[model samples]
Target: MNNLFDLHLQIGSRRARQHIQDTPLWQLKQFTRKKKVPDLSSLEKFERSRKRFERKDRLLAIASLSRFAKLDIGREKRKGLPEVILAEGKLATDVAKITQAMLKRTGRAVVSRLTGSQVKAVRSIIGKEAKIEYFSRSRMMVVKSHSYTPRQSGGRVGILTAGTSDIPVAEEAEVIAREMGCETRSFFDVGVAGIHRLFEPVRDLLKWEADVILVVAGREGALPTVVAGIVDVPVIGVPTSRSYGFGERGLSALAAMLQSCSLGMAVVNIDGGVGAGAVAALVANRVGEYRTRVA
Candidate 1:
């Protein structure tokens, strides 16, 4: 029995050797050879490449200022919408810091809803370093470095206000659209109360070949619906806080716009001029880009 067991073991050993011989030499070498560790110079080169990539990433990364804000520095590159600083609630000093940082990084900065004090702070901080265009009615400011140039997308935006009270909101939208490189034509004091006033402006917008229209209204907010019905291009309805009583603070206007019976009309939040303008600019820019490509 011992002799038989020894012969079986020898036969198994011979089969194992035959299988090893039949295996590919490369496969055998993979198991037999040790992986070569990278040399010091190669490791240094890889580290340098990694650091270079990290540097570039940092340039495009969100700029964090202590704990208060994380400025999206790469918004324009990523979304085609420039980052707009809303200075309504922030401290003036903080706004100034953010504006300076944004200007340094992007060569341009847009600030919306700026209080008088905030405006002063920003001007004091960045006045000598950049060119600041402040629109008092809209409470918006555009800051540009000396080397900065506004991009022209060959897009046109037509803006209309239902009433004079709604002009401030409409102005905000116009500023945003212009900053996005769209040519804007705006008309004010055309409300549903005086329906006839809208016809000429609507006709002019059509003749000017507007890519999109922003209609700003308050109270019952019927003007956007009217404009939407008349215009062939896209229409964005912006409700303002110019009403009173039960639907005060733009609630009624918001509701009316949301419930608009007009086709091809969209509504933003009450007093959301920034969002309205950004969306309109996006649509116009895309249209313009397509026109350019086709032409």
Candidate 2:
């Protein structure tokens, strides 16, 4: 019956073989007994099995912080990414507490949109116990336990900014990508206004053999479209809150990107460096795994 259910998943005979190898007989019996039927359809059995695994994964690791926040320490295991702390509107002390809690469980925490005071507070909390890297341009900070090491892998990310002002967001993306163990190459001040300014960096990125690219833009947000047209890799557009007056704070930029005609282009939220960075890293990680298998 278990083999039949696995066949219903259509994941191939190799995966079915893995299922039998990895799952204990007692555990499989427990799953089968729950349905309370000697005979059952494969779909019904699979649904029950899927839900059981989902619930187990979801409840695996949780840390409580004074009834205010419950940190999902199992997020990295379940989602292939760690849970990050957002410090944009939170008090400095609160951010520190959350970071400390996360570090206690996961050995690492990323805090985004951190103010200068928040950085000081977080450093004070961890003291000499951990390492804290802060980027003033991006307003992002990474806290890692003393035992942490960069788990380097196979793919590369190319980050580009349309203007100097967009560098902060690009920097944020770079820091996150590096932390996630993806090699990153950056290109700056290459907007559509000076089309020629982009050519050299695009060539350089190709030379570096980037697996994915992210383009950060503010005013018109056409950089990603242009990049997607040129690069064979996937392109992610980051719309920064960098303009004023008529369009006002990246509204026009966001809209323009959402409507981009380019085939392989996607857009993130206004000043959403963390989101873009995380997504790019995930793609790079998957590509790296594929390369490793093929090699």
Residue 275 deviation, candidate 1, in Å? 0.4
Clashes within 3 Å, all models in order:
0, 0
lDDT comparing candidate 2 with the true structure: 0.85
- lDDT (0 to 1) per candidate: 0.85, 0.85
lDDT of 2 by residue, 221-290 (tens): 8899999998899999999999998887999899999999999988999999888998999999889888
Q: Mind sharing the TM-score for model 1?
A: 0.80
Candidate 1 per-residue C-alpha lDDT over 1-295 given as tens digits, one digit per residue, 9 for 90 to 100: 2232233235347654345434444443343333332233433443455567656775677988789888898788778889999998899999999999999989999999999899999999996899999998889999999989898997899999999999889988999898898999999999988888889999999999999999999888889999998788999999999989988999989998888888999999999999999999999999989888999
Model 1: lDDT equals 0.85
My TM-score estimates for the predictions, one after another, are 0.80, 0.81
Instruction: Indicate which candidate wins on TM-score.
Output: 2
